[model samples]
Target: MESPSKGYLDVGHLELGGTIQSHSSKFIPSDKAEFNRNMLSRNKIISVCLLLLVITLSGCSRINSAQGWSGILVDDDRLILASMDGHIMVLDKNTGKHMWEPDLMRVKEKDEKKRAAYGLPAVSNGILFVGVYSGKIQAVEVDTGRTVETEV
Candidate 1:
């Protein structure tokens, strides 16, 4: 009965390395499982961040939908304003009451100027002329809210 070597061990016909190597192999599967769990956690975090970013962008778009950059126009008794949402609104100059918003183009149309107006509304002889950002000019009657002419 001779004693085994110091750095080697024999177990049931299988030979294993010293204490450090054998202990490390025992922990390898658990370490690998922990690493995989960490990777899954990181992926989940990234997905959550992307979802939050999309939600924030959608909220900003909704906030910007009703805003405009076109200059204001004051006619005889109405205050005219152009909205970036492609609407020309007429309100009472003094009371700020809602009067009318004329349709420049169909909302469901595929025109490039559907929701953008960058030019000031010009009023001449009861006719309001507006220019669309997508290269179209519309002449609308001030009082009747009728589109008199449309030029593209």
Candidate 2:
């Protein structure tokens, strides 16, 4: 976010330039007057563009789960969440619902330990990034919901 303290936000008056009449082009400096008009117009355009971008991007993907108070993250437009039991979930953002989740413990030994963490899930470039309690970092596909890479 930009520095909010550096900008002027007036609450004292309704009209711009503090109630100047439309036809009163009295003693305003040309450069300062042009700058004020240009800045106002530019800020309005930029604000609208930013609003549109946020709405469009936030519609991309989302994910939520019934895990034990875990966390989630966005992988590009895809959503990734994790459970305390090492289960990974992926979702489509438009609905805040899961698209896929895998039983990470299914193929492991029955005595395998579970991965748990207090940190929020992290994702990047279509890869759902996560860390296990055993010190392993894992990255999975945001689309197919498969483990694409892993490291310590």
Candidate 3:
């Protein structure tokens, strides 16, 4: 394989039992050094841009996935809340104590984002209905925390 030549002048030819030499008066050592410095600075700029892009994407994911806000329903003395992580929590309205263990209402689907609750819970005829971001509605008995039905 043969490699391509650069900007050097091909002024001399090789002879049998002789040496070949070439020189270009237009080339300067300082110009080569400046070219290298320019390339280095360009690489640094590109690297910093990529790093900033990664940081921005990570921050956006944290903002979207973080859990905190969810709607709550006060049914009689019990406080019913839907957690952002796809669970139903029943708490006492007055003392703020857990009425029952938090129940798993929805789960993450394959190739989908994590399940989250975004709407207020509803109670009708002693049944609590909670809607999740995964397009499912979970119904449970508000008194016993028993599962009544689920619609997906």
Each model's lDDT: 0.67, 0.59, 0.70
TM-score of 1: 0.48
Off by over 4 Å in 3: 1-60, 63-65, 102-114, 150-152
Report the lDDT of model 2 for residue 1: 20
- Candidate order by TM-score, decreasing, is 3, 1, 2
Off by over 4 Å in 2: 1-67, 75-77, 101-111
Native-to-model Cα distance after best TM-score fit, residue 21 in candidate 1, in Å: 64
lDDT of 3 at 76: 92
Residue-wise lDDT of candidate 1 within 1-152, one digit each (tens)? Answer: 23345443433333457423222122335667799999999999999999999987886674546565587898878888876667777788999976665323321225745656667888888887777666666677788677785544
User: Model 3 over residues 8-105: C-alpha lDDT tens digits?
Assistant: 44454545566544434334457887999999999999999999999878865756566644787888998888777777788889998887755333
Candidate 1 segments exceeding 4 Å error:
1-66, 101-109, 112-115, 150-152
Q: Of 1 and 3, which scores higher on TM-score?
A: 3
TM-score of each: 0.48, 0.43, 0.50
Supply every candidate's count of residue pairs whose N, Cα or C atoms clash at under 3 angstroms.
Answer: 0, 3, 0
Every candidate's CA RMSD: 9.9, 16.7, 10.7
